[model samples]
Target: MRILTVVGARPQFVKAAAISRAVTAHDQSKGDLEDVIVHTGQHYDESMSRSFFDGLGIPEPRHNLGIGSTTHGRQTGLMMNALEDIIDLESPDVVVVHGDTNSTLAGALVATKRNLPLVHVEAGLRSFDRTMPEEVNRVLTDHVSDLLCCPSSTAVDNLEAEGIVDGVHLVGDVMYDVLLDDLATLDSMASPVDSLAVDPPYVVATIHRASTTDDPKRFDDIVHALTQVATTIAPVVWPVHPRTSDLVGGLTVPDSLHLIDPVSYHEMLLLVRGARTVVTDSGGLQKEAYWLETPCVTVRDTTEWTETIDAGWNSLTGTDPDRIFEAVDNSSAPETHPPLYGDGHSAGRIVELVRSLPH
Candidate 1:
C-alpha cells in the first residue's frame, strides 16, 4: 500500500511522525507498505520545519511545495496547483491528510479531483464557529474523506450530525500516540526549561493565532495578562512563532515574559510537562496540555477539544485580560487523567484501517 501523506504545520509533523513509525513497523512485518510524505511548507522557517523531522524521525517529504505565508485562498491554491502534479506523478492509492489547515483541504481537493481515496486523520473535529477557518476545513475534509478517523466520541458525534456516517472510524488521537512514545525517553533528553533560566512552577504561553495576534487589542490584552501571571502567579515562558516574530518586536515586553525562538518537538514536550499552566490559542496545545495534565487556559472563546474542558482540565477565557490572568492563577486539573483519545497504539489501528480500504 502506497500512502501519500500531506503535512504542513508543526502539529501535523508530530502526527505524521506517529503514522510514519506505524508504517515502518507494518512494512517490516507485513511488507508492501509505503508512506510518502509531501511537505507544503505552510510553516516556512527552517527552525520550525526541519527540526520537527529530525526530532520526531518522520521521513523527509518527497516533495516540499514551499507554499509559505500568503492569504489563505492563495496559499491553498498554490498548494493545489503544485500537489496535483505530484499526485499524478506518484499515483498513490490513498492520500492522507492530518489536520484542518489549508494544506489539509488542499491535499483533500487534489486527491478527490484525481479520483483517489482520501483518508483524513483528526477528522470530524468542530468548534461550531463558521467564522474560524479550521472549522470550515474540518467540515469540508470530513465530507470528502473516504476514511474519517476521529480522535474522540464528540468528534464522531459532530460528523453524524453533519450526515457523514459512512467510512467513519473512531481511531484515537495520533498526537497521544506520539506523546506516549516520547514519554519513555523524555527524561533522558536535555531540558530546554533549564536553558531558559526559568525556575519550576512557570507558565508556558504560546499565542500565535490570527484572532489574538492580528487583533491589536486582543494581543495587547494577552500580553498584559501574561505579564500579570509572571508578576503574581509564575513567570511566562513563551516560544514565539515565526509568523508572530515581526509583531513581537514593537511590543514593550517585560523581562518576566521570556520571549525565545521555537524549540524542537521533544523540547516542547518537556516544556509543557513542566509548566504550571499552559496558555495558548493553538488547538494542538490544548490537547497536549490535557495529556500532560497541565492546567490550560485557552485564549479563544471556543475549542474543538471540548472534552478537555468537560474533564475540568481546561478553561476558556477568550482575550479578556482579567479572565486570562485569573484562569492562570486558578488553573487546576482533576485527579485522574483518563485516556480520552486512546492508548499508544492508535497508529497501528490506523494502519490496519488503511490496509482494509479497497484500492
Candidate 2:
C-alpha cells in the first residue's frame, strides 16, 4: 500500500517523523508499504523547516510545494489545489495527515473530493471553542476522515460526543513516540544551555499564538510576571517567535529575560529537557515538558491536552499577570511522572491500522 503524508508545520513534522519511521519499518517487514511525503511549506523558515527532519532523522519529502505564508483562505486553497494535483499523480491508497494544521485540513478536503480514504492522526482533539482556527480544522478533518486515530480516551469521547462514531481508534499519540525517540538520540549531544544564554535552573518561556503575544495587555502581563519571579541567578530565556517578535519590537523586555532567536527542534528539545520549568502557550510544548519530567505553566485560557493538568505536572495560568505569578509561585517542583499521553508506541499502532484498512 502506498500512502501520501502531509506535513507543513513544526509539530506536523515531528508527528510525521514517527509515522515515516513506522512506514519504513513496515515496508522492511512486509515489503508492501510505500510512503510519499509532501511538504506544504506552511512553515517556510529554514530553521523551522530543515532542522526538524535533520534532527529527527525523518526522510526528505518527495515534494516541497514551497507555499510559504499567506492569508488563511489563500494558503489552504493553494494547498488544496497542490495536493489534488499530487493525488492525481501519485494515486496512493490512503492519504495521511497529522494534527489540525491548515495543511491537514487542506489534505483532507482534497482526499475527500477525490474519494480517497483519509486518515487523521491525532484526531478528535477539541478545546470546545470555535474561535480557534485549529479547532475548526480538527472538526472538519474528523468529519471527513475515514480513520480517526485518537491519542487519548478523552479524544475518542469528544468525537463520539460530536457524532463521529466511524473509524475512531485509540491509537496512542505519535508525538509521544517522536519525543521518546528524539530524546534518546539527542540527549548525548551538547546541551543548548550556552546558546540560550541562561543558567541551568532557568524557566524557558515560549509564546507563539497571536492571541497571547499580539495583544498588548496580555503580552505585557506575561513579561511582568516573568520579571516578578525572584530567581537571582537563573534568567528567563525566551526564544521569541517571529510573529511575536515583530509585534513586540522596541518594547521594553525585562533585564532578567534573555530573548534569543528560535532554535531548532533538537535544540528546543534539549532546552525543554534541561530546564527548571517551562512556561508556554504551545500545546506541543506542554506535552513535551510533561514527557521530559519538567514542570510547565500553560499561558493559554484553554488547552486540549487536559491530561497534563490531570497529572498535576502543568498548570493553566492564562495571560493574567497576577494569575501567572500566582500559578508560578504556588507551583512546587514536579515529582509525579504519569503516562498521560501513551506508552510511546503510537507510531506502530497507527501504521498497523493503516495497513489493515480495506483499500
Candidate 3:
C-alpha cells in the first residue's frame, strides 16, 4: 500500500511527523507501506517551516509545490494545479491530508476527483464560523474524504451532527503522540528564548490571528490588554508572529512586555511548560497548554477545542482587556486531566486502519 501525504503549515508538519514515524515502524504482510510527502510552501519562512522539519526530525518532502503566500483562492488553485500533476504521476492508492490548511482542501479535491481514496487525519473539527478559512477547509474535506480520522469523541459527535457516520473512526490526535514522544527531548534542550532576558513564571502571549491583527482597533485593544496584564502579572513574554511584528513596529510597547521573534518548536514547548499562564489566539497552543497542564487564556471569541474550556483549564477572553485580566488572574489547571486526546498511540492506530483498506 502506498500513501501520499500533503502538508503545508507548521501545525500540519508537527501532526504529520507522528504518522510518518508510525508508518515506518509498523510492518504489513500485504506489502511494504510506501509513504510519500509533499510540501506546499504555504508557510515559506524558514523559522515557520523548515526549522520544524529539522527540529522534529521529519524527513524532507519528496515534492515541494513552492506555493508561497498569496490570496486564498490563488494559493489553493496553485496547489491544486501542482498537486494534480503529482497525483497523475504517482497515482498512489490513498492520498492523506492533515488539518485544515489550504493544502488539505487541495489534496482532498484532487484525490477525490482522481477517484483515489482520500484519508483525512484530524478531521471533524468546526469553529462554526464561516469567516475562518480553516473551518471551511476542514468541513469540505470531511464531506469528500473516504476515511475520517477523528481526534476526540467531541469531533466524532460533530461529524455525526453533520450526518457523516460512515468511514469515520476515532483515531485520536497525532499531535499528542508527537508531544509524548518529544517532551523529554524538548525539555532537555536549552530554550533559545532564555537569552532574551525573560524569566519563568511569566505570562506567554502570542497574538497573530487575522481577526485581531487585521483590524486596527482590535490589535490596539490586544496590545493594551497585554500591557494591563503585565502590570498585574509582571512580565509578559510574547513570541510575536512575523505579521504581528510589522504592525507592532509602529506602536509603542511597554517595558513589561517582551516582544521577540518567533522561537523554534522545542523552544516554544519549553516556554509554555514554564509559563505562569499562556495567552494566545493559536488553536495549536490551546491544545498544547491543555496537554502540559498549564492554564490558558485564549484571545479568540470561539475555539474549536471546546473541551479545554469545558474542563476549566482554558478561558475565552477575546480581545477585551478586562476579560483578559480577569481570566488570566483566575486561570488554573484542573486537578486531574483524565487523559484527553489519546494515550500517544494515535499514529499507530491510523497506520493500521489505512493498511487494512483494500487499496
Candidate 4:
C-alpha cells in the first residue's frame, strides 16, 4: 500500500512525523507499505519548515511544491493544480491530508476530483465560525474525507452531529503521538528558551494567527496586552513567526516581551512544557499546553479544541487587554487533566486504517 501524504505548514509536519515513523515500522514488519510526503511549501522558511523536518526526522519530501506566501485563492488553487499532476504521476492508494490549512483543502479537492480515496487526520474539528478560513477548510475536508481520524470523543461527536458517520474512527491525535516521543528527547536538547535569559514561572507566547495579527489595530492591541502581561504577571518568551516579526519590527515592544527566532519542533515542545502559562491563538499550542499541564490563555474567542476549555486547562481572552491580563493573572491549570487526546499510539492506528483502504 502506498499513501501520498500532503503537508504544508509547521503543525502538519509534527503530526506527519508520527505517521511517518509508524510507516517505517510497518515497512520493517509488514514490508508492503510506502509513504510519499508532498510538502506544499506554504511555510518555506528554514525555521518553520526545514527545522521541523530535521528535528522530527521526517524523510525528505518526494515533492516540494514551492507555493509560498500568497492570497488564499492563489495558494490553494496553485496547490490543487500541482497536486493533480502529482496524483496522476504517483497514483497512490490514498491521499492523506492533515489539519485545516489551505494546503489541506487543496489536497482534498484534487484527490476527490481524481477519484482517489482521501484520509483526513485531525478531522471533525469545528469552531462553528465560517468567517475563519480554517473553519471552512476543516468542515469541507471532513465532508470529503474517505476516512476521518478523530483525536477525541468530542471530535467524534462533532462528526456525528454533522451526519458524517461513515469511515470515522477515533484514532486519537497524531501530534500527541509525536509529542510523547519528543518529550523524552527534551533532556538531551539544549533548551530553546535558555538563550532568552528568562527565569522559571515565565509565560511562553506565540501570537501570529491572522485573526489576531492581520489588522494593524488588533495586532497593536494584542501586543499591548502582551506587554501588560509581561509587565505585571510574568516575563514572556515569544518564538516569533516571520510574518509577525515583520509587523513587530516596527512596533515599540517592551524588554520583558522577549522575542526570538522560531525554534525547531522539539525545542518548541520543551518551551511549552516548561512554561508557567501559554498565550496563543494557535490551535495546536492550546492542546500542547493542556497536555503539558500548563495553563493556557488563548487570544482567540473560539477554539475548535473545546475539550481543553472544558478540562479547565485553557482560557479564552479574545485580544482584549483587560480580559487578557485577567486571564493571565488567574491562569491555573486544574490539578487533574483527564486523558484528552490519546495514549500516544495514534500513528499505528492511523497507518493501519490507511492500509485498510481499497486501492
Lowest summed lDDT over 10 consecutive residues: which window, candidate 3? 23-32
Give all candidates' CA lDDT scores.
Answer: 0.90, 0.85, 0.87, 0.89
- Per-residue accuracy of model 4 over 159-210 as CA lDDT, tens digit each: 9999999999998999899888877788788777678778878999898777
- Over 4 Å off, model 2: 195-197, 230-234
User: Any runs in candidate 1 off by more than 4 Å, and if so which?
Assistant: none
lDDT of 3 by residue, 272-318 (tens): 89888999999999999999888999998888888898888888988
Model 3 ranges with Cα > 4 A deviation:
27-31
lDDT of 2: 0.85
Can you rank all candidates by lDDT, best first? Answer: 1, 4, 3, 2
Q: Which model, 1 or 2, shows the larger lDDT?
A: 1
lDDT of 2 at 277: 82
Of the candidates numbered 2 and 4, which has the greater lDDT value? 4
Q: Candidate 2 clashing pairs?
A: none
Residue 91, candidate 4: Cα error in Å is 1.6
TM-score list, all predictions: 0.98, 0.94, 0.96, 0.98
lDDT of 4: 0.89
Deviation of model 3 at 196, angstroms:
2.9
| Higher-scoring candidate on TM-score, 1 or 3 | 1
